[model samples]
Target: MGDGLLVFDGRCGFCTRSVGWARALDRRGRVEMRPYQEPGVPESIGTDAATCSEAVQWQGRDGVRLEGAAAVNALLDTVSGTRIPSTVYRVTGGLQERVYRWVADHRSRFPGMTPYCESHPAECAS
Candidate 1:
């Protein structure tokens, strides 16, 4: 209901591009995006590097945690007023989770994808 945080793999090109799109849709700035690789980010978000590496993490202002497809649905809920996507994900009987996992597993194979660190060198700089 209030502000939310989305923790993602900063080095992933697909993940970065997806977050970029989400940022554009978030006109209200309800969600904040952070790279798990960033120093102290995982600890600050109450998540560990291993968990974040497996799936995107979303922490609601209410302190509820969601990961993978659920996490994406939560972000979508914030940027858009409609709950149709979440509903669809729920009714699909784990299909959404499977799809999310597939994408995560093969993210690097996507054609034309570039790692965020490579595309945005300055941003990834330590």
Candidate 2:
């Protein structure tokens, strides 16, 4: 892979936390994170930053794009070569996708989420 681009909502508390976790797991910085709101991002892989704030995305080698579960899986692929236990998350499939959607949809109601969102509501995309 040229480099893994993890497009995520920079304003989301959960998203920020996850990014921190991933960064810690891959201290070499193999994955590059770009806020979906960045200007000039290509739309071919669904790069509408505002809209994509509600989803997960990962662009892999050869421009293979994965969303939701597959996106999470692709990110794991980058750390697989390291000491990270990739197999531990083998089941991030359909079920996980549904759960992800649910949490994302209702994230505003989650504890500590309101304060986080209030601090960056402009980027939260409602």
Candidate 3:
């Protein structure tokens, strides 16, 4: 695995949990996960913060990018315990995007997210 940056919504509990899981699985120490709220995150990737607000973004070492479900797949490819997801992504065409969108759209209702958002009311909508 090579170095890359994964920018995600730090306020969302689901996203935070997913990031932790990925980080634990990424034994190669190749991927670095950063929250959208982090200073200079968007600038470092040459994109606006609004894009990170919309979906997880993966900035490859060579400046390539993968957004939303594509970003998840790319990160999973680098993690050892995520082979099934990578395989499903490779064969499923747009399925991953649909699933990712559905989950992202309904993230507010997810367990742990509601309580986590109490500290930041604005991020609940994110």
Candidate 4:
């Protein structure tokens, strides 16, 4: 575990669930998950509210920063049994990013998705 950080949008249900899925695979507890909306979180991570609103952010223990699909890939790399898919994701040129953007844009339309903020306003209040 490198104490890596995964900053996501707490207001997005899809994002929260997606992070849960990732956490399930993180048997080693290599990453620390944080909601960007948390007080001082964005500034602490050298990012801004606007940037976090647009995409997920990953900060490695070594200080490397990644965003969007690349950030997802970096998170995957921390988990075992993901080498094949991670490689495919990396080799897909720009396709992975396009796919990520599409999914992000339509995330609310996904069945069973509900923003965490909506369901847990007290915990997500800014």
Q: 14-92 in candidate 4: lDDT tens per residue? A: 8988988989999988888888877777777788989999999988788877889988988888776456656878689
Worst 10 residues of 1 by lDDT: 117-126
User: Global lDDT of each model?
Assistant: 0.84, 0.65, 0.77, 0.81
Runs of candidate 1 with Cα error greater than 4 angstroms are: 111-114, 118-126
| Number of the top-ranking candidate, with lDDT as the measure | 1
TM-score to true structure, per model: 0.86, 0.70, 0.79, 0.85
Q: What lDDT tens digits, residue by residue, belong to model 3 across residues 52-93?
A: 888999987778888999888878776654567667787984
As for model 4, its CA RMSD to the true structure in angstroms is 2.3
Ranking by lDDT: 1, 4, 3, 2
**By the lDDT metric, which is better: model 1 or model 3?**
1
Q: Considering TM-score, where higher is better, how would the candidates rank from best to worst? A: 1, 4, 3, 2
* Residue clash pairs of candidate 4: 13-115
In model 1, pairs of residues that clash are none
Q: Give the TM-score of candidate 2.
A: 0.70
